[model samples]
Target: MATGTGIGTEIQISDSSDEQVILKTKMIKLDTHNWVQWSCQMENYLTARRYDDLFMPPSEETKRSSKFRQKNSSALALLWGCVSSELEGVLLDNKTSFYDTWEVLGNICGKNSIVTICETFYELISLKYKPESSLQAHIHSFQKLCARYNSITSDKVLKATFPPKLLAATFIRSLNGDKELTGLVQTLYDIKPFTPAAVISRVAIEHSRRQPNEQALFAGSSNKSMQKTKWDEQKQRNKGQRSGKKYDKPGPSDKNDSDKRMDNIKKMLEKLQASMKPQSAHLTTESNIKTVVPTLMLS
Candidate 1:
């Protein structure tokens, strides 16, 4: 069956094998965060397989052709497989052509309105690093938000307000005062062409260094505390020994020497008393003889 020509030139399907080959090739599924990239990839895949014409309306000659309807249905089925389940429900009741469906999906997920773009831009600028979240993950999320906002907005707006320098500055300002990250951001701003990717890489490296450095510091403090405790204990033990030595009393041998000194003083006093008694006896006998001789002379 012959199909009608569309916006792109009519692709004459001469062989069934080529159709099967195109059908067999898997397409990348779309997600909310990656719609822009996914759409680009889908366009490239459709163009490469010469099936892009299926997305456009048929020409006048093929408007009533059954073969054109069959071709559109096949292309729609393939497109359905490439979308996520969340988007499937939105497009399920859509009775439009493949091109209309594609546009609808883009509008829904792409958020092409100026308000949406501005909101996304504000969110990117306001994105802050959470202590519980990973630093690298936060940086990556901000980068993706910036990319999406840039894709939606015009180059003039981006250049005037959200330039690369401003993006880098915003990212640096959102950090939660990590010294390594702050220093790296400062270095990045000092250099020419402030690239966000460089800042992300430096942040990852700094995060890795910070973990080990913090661990080492903690271990060092623990060791110092333990050493201090041991030193204090030793000082107390030495002090107790010195106190015991300073107030220590004498033993049994010292008591025996003191008793021996008291006994020697008593023996010396007894010897002097015994010698004085012999002299006293001689003087008494001499006095009695003198008294008797005086009585005889008087008679």
Candidate 2:
């Protein structure tokens, strides 16, 4: 029967053997604390089904847009070098947040679209995204920084954080040398106020540089991706399947669940004391250190 959109519990599993042996089985439900788990599971499902719904072909526009979408500093530096310095201007001005002390500036204004937002002191992320808007709507803030830096600096974008795969992609692109992007090499370092579109162009150029010998970049990208994924997988394993708790370590909930908690040594002492023959066990000085004095001297 169709249990509908939400998860339905009481899933059943059955096991049977020959000779009339029967046993009850248990059910399993899947959910995680965050969307990452949901996304990974969804990807696994799609891969298993061989679904081709969302495969996007590489496009100049998409490539150009990727700088802003680039992974954070760790991956960006390995992929691009110091040529990505223009990223400094892309700094997030977060003076606002409910949970945080600073407030967030909410505008999608670009150096290109200076007409819309009149604010002179800070940059804005618009707190929202729109396709027709000057800035990219859904792109992550850091990814755009790479694009903005690359665009203004051209092909010469240096990055503080780099991913080896991005370098591999760039190295492969270098083989073709479309010289049309000749100026791009210089612009990545251009430390001037620029727009989101400039960022997109830089990213496109970077990807184009790899398009010539796509195979190597592809392989490098794939291997590096796998390595990265492996690292992430290792991280998830650490997260979901951490090493069993140490003998002395207590879980976060242990403080609240004191009633269910056990003092192994105390329990053992009680068992030993109860099992011992009358007065068979005598407390020594070392054991007496923890002994309780029941009587008090007269004041």
Best by lDDT: 1
lDDT of each: 0.62, 0.34
Please report how far candidate 2 places residue 131 from its true position, in Å: 28
Worst 10-residue stretch by lDDT in candidate 1?
A: 6-15
Encode model 2's per-residue lDDT on 115-158: one tens digit a residue. 32222102222222332222222234435434443332232332
Question: TM-scores of the models, in the given order?
Answer: 0.49, 0.16
Using TM-score as the measure, the top candidate is: 1
| Model 2 misplacement above 4 A | 1-259, 264-268, 283-299
Q: Give lDDT tens digits, candidate 1, residues 225-297.
A: 9999988966665566457532133344346643664456446445544667775645334455446443432
After superposing candidate 1, which stretches have Cα over 4 Å from the reference? Answer: 1-15, 19-49, 55-58, 61-71, 79-96, 108-111, 154-161, 177-188, 211-299
lDDT for 255 (candidate 2): 50
